[model samples]
Target chain A: MSAVERIPILKIGDVLLASIQVDLQDRDVLALQEDLAEKITATGAHGVVLDISAVDIVDSFIGRMFATIAATSRLFDAHTVVVGMRPAVAITLVELGLTLGEVRTALDLEKGLAILAELGERAPR
Target chain B: MTAAREDIPIAADEDVVRVRQIVRSFAQRAKLSLVDQTKLVTATSELARNTLTYGGGGAAVVELLGEGRRQGVRASFQDSGPGIPDTALALTDGWTSGRGMGLGLSGARRLVDEFDLDTEVGRGTTVTVVKWSR
Candidate 1:
């Protein structure tokens, strides 16, 4: 069996970036959620950008995981923005009636960081 | 193009990921477009999840095929658990019997060129889908 591949969450300034490039397993999903939550507390980040451009597919569980990450980050006073979703993934999400509730999305990482920056400015310090 | 067939076990979420990988490998071998590959892989993942979660475990068979000048891949899911009580309702958007968002059947059908479902209460369920290369 191949070794486990973990999604690395890198911090740039006050924003955390997590790029998903693998077809994640169940444990991997749980690991990401746990790791992101821990990183938020450890880094004191004010924003997070998850780049899923390499993620070609997402089911309800995966979609729910994304929403959970965003919701969890909000608890730490950090904003989360998802970026780089392919067109086909969008279509599947819509067809499944998954809105990714309250999780912001952008076309790419640059725009995602920009949105987070904008939100950070609007947030009451 | 009916060249190869593979049966993958689906007893857990890990198996679901495995199914997607199998789909991806076949899609690449068939020279499907990236978009098409993503669609089929997504569809197969959903189906595999349904088999593992709702069906109490099952298997998916990936097959490569050819008709005239058309080439494609087909994934068929089979399970020995309780069958769906209402397949039509199950296929509806946002309708789920368990915890899912009900995208397994409907969304999968949309992503592929052909889809077929077979189930018998107290017997089992089977779902088949095909995506032709464009």
Candidate 2:
């Protein structure tokens, strides 16, 4: 088996940006959740943006990972917005009945950043 | 009729990724639309993970089908683990016996053109799915 890959999380202002650039394995998704949680705590960031344009496929596990990440981040006072979901992926997720459950989504990175910024402004200090 | 066939072992998480890749290739070869390819690959990913996690590791067989005007891709996941005792419950959405959201089986059924599940308690399980180009 190949080594589990980690998705890099970059901090821009108060929001953390994680662009998924590889075909993620199940272990990788789990690891990313763990890492993102740690990073959220360490950085004390208020928002998270996940870029999934490169992700061409998503099953229930991957779909759940998005919702799980959002739910987990909320506990740490961080909001997560998924961005750049391919049109085909969106359709497939719908057909699979995985709605991603209340996770905010945007069309791209810039738009995702905009949503995070808006959310950040509304968050109580 | 199947023009080509390949078998892959589903022992770990990485194997699930491999299954997606193989299924995508077969889907592409069958000339499935991009959306169809994505759906089929996604379904394969769910089934492959089920084979590894619930089925205690098994094998996945991918086939490229060509029949008259219908070109398609088919994948069958088979395992010898403790078979699902209640297939009806297992097929219900959000009824997971594990960490998953329970969408694997039910959701996969919606993504493909055909879905078949065969299981027996203490025996084994096999799930076959196919998606034809439209």
Candidate 3:
């Protein structure tokens, strides 16, 4: 039986960080999308930060998957932020008309964390 | 040998890189703006990958239309795999027969100026896309 590869999980203060590895092969994309959503739900953190710095391209499918994860994370009462999108990938996403307006994005992990902190403070009691 | 241009078959996933290279070459030859080039290339990649995955391999034929006037590029992707049953549902954003979000065909259509699809059950499917110079 083939062993399942575990996605890397990192704890950054109160935030649960999950980094997506760079391969981005066609077959792995769907699974990666589902896994990211599950991780966010299970962690029950204040916010979920996804680092896709390793990914060089954001194909249509993957781009949609990111939107799905963001929507799903919100259902679990967690905010989702995607960081480290490559310039080419960003351009491709825009060209493909995938306006990830719902998914908060930042230039780097630090910016993502800062946004998360701001969102955290603004949450309703 | 000088052969008719229409007689040539589109090239499929000979290699993953082939799709991108062809896109870049065609974009330059067509004199498409950078934004339009990226849009067309991304759409081309999605369609090419579909040909490889569901079609069990196929070819994409690209041609630059209108020499001096009305210039544009037309790309046709033909595959010998089972054709889609419901064209309308297939065009829906979230519909997919496989793991994909079903965005390939729909998104490809959205990226270009003109899109056409023809298919027959058990026969095959052919998608043609055109991007005009703006």
Candidate 4:
């Protein structure tokens, strides 16, 4: 097994942004989920923006990771919006029968942050 | 007809990523479109993980092929681990013997142009899939 890699999580206001710029291994996926959960708890962020523009492909494992991350974030009242999914990746996921349940998605980083911002406004202060 | 071939060992999580990279490159070399390449790589990723986890580690053989005017990428995953006892149930969607979403075989078949499964109760299993350029 190779060393687990961490996806850098950046904070913009109360929203945490995790941009996945590398091809993810299974271990890396698990590490990201753990890291995101911890960050949400520590920072008390209201929203998360997962930017996957650089992700070239996704299987069932990675697809489920999105749902898992969103589900985890909800526990801390954080909304996750996955962004920048490539068209090819989107088509493949649909054909593979993965709906990415419970994971909200957007077209790009700008739109994703917008959604998060809107959700943040709607949340109870 | 095979134009080029590479064998990748699926022993760990990293190997699964390697398998995806190899398949992606081979798909490109075969002149597959971006969507086709993505589909093949994604399907291979699922199969590679199954080889490492359920199959208890294995090897993947990827091939670039040309038949007349058709160019295609083919990959075969083979493992010496205990073979699946119930292939039918194994292929059923949402049915998992482990932690997977049970889309490895069935889902892979959906993404490719061709898929074949050869398995025995205790003799190990081999899954071969192909994606042809359009």
Best by DockQ: 2
In TM-score terms, candidate 2 sits at: 0.97
Cα lDDT listed for each candidate: 0.87, 0.92, 0.73, 0.90
Ten-residue stretch with the least lDDT total in model 4 chain A? A116-125
DockQ for every prediction shown: 0.56, 0.90, 0.22, 0.86
In model 2, pairs of residues that clash are none
**Clash-forming residue pairs, model 3:** none
**lDDT, model 2, position A7:** 91
- Please name the candidate that would achieve the greatest lDDT relative to the true structure: 2
RMSD of 2: 1.6
TM-score of chain A of 4: 0.96
How would the candidate models be sorted by DockQ, starting from the highest?
2, 4, 1, 3
C-alpha TM-score for every candidate = 0.89, 0.97, 0.67, 0.97
Segments in model 2 whose C-alpha atoms lie over 4 Å from true places: B1-3
Cα lDDT for residue B36, candidate 4 = 96
lDDT of 4 at A112: 89
* Chain A TM-score across all models, in listed order: 0.95, 0.97, 0.83, 0.96
For model 2, residues B34-112, the per-residue Cα lDDT tens digits are 9999999999998998999999999999998889998998899999999999999999999998877899999999999
lDDT of 4 by residue, A18-99 (tens): 9998889888999999999999999999999999899999889888889999999998999999999999999998899998
Clashing pairs in 4: none
| Pairwise lDDT winner, candidates 3 and 4 | 4
What is the alpha-carbon interface RMSD for each candidate?
A: 2.6, 0.9, 5.0, 1.0
The digit string of per-residue lDDT tens for model 4 on B86-117 reads 88888888888776688888999999999999
Poorest 10 consecutive residues of model 2 chain A by lDDT? A116-125
From the highest TM-score down, the ranking of the candidates is 2, 4, 1, 3
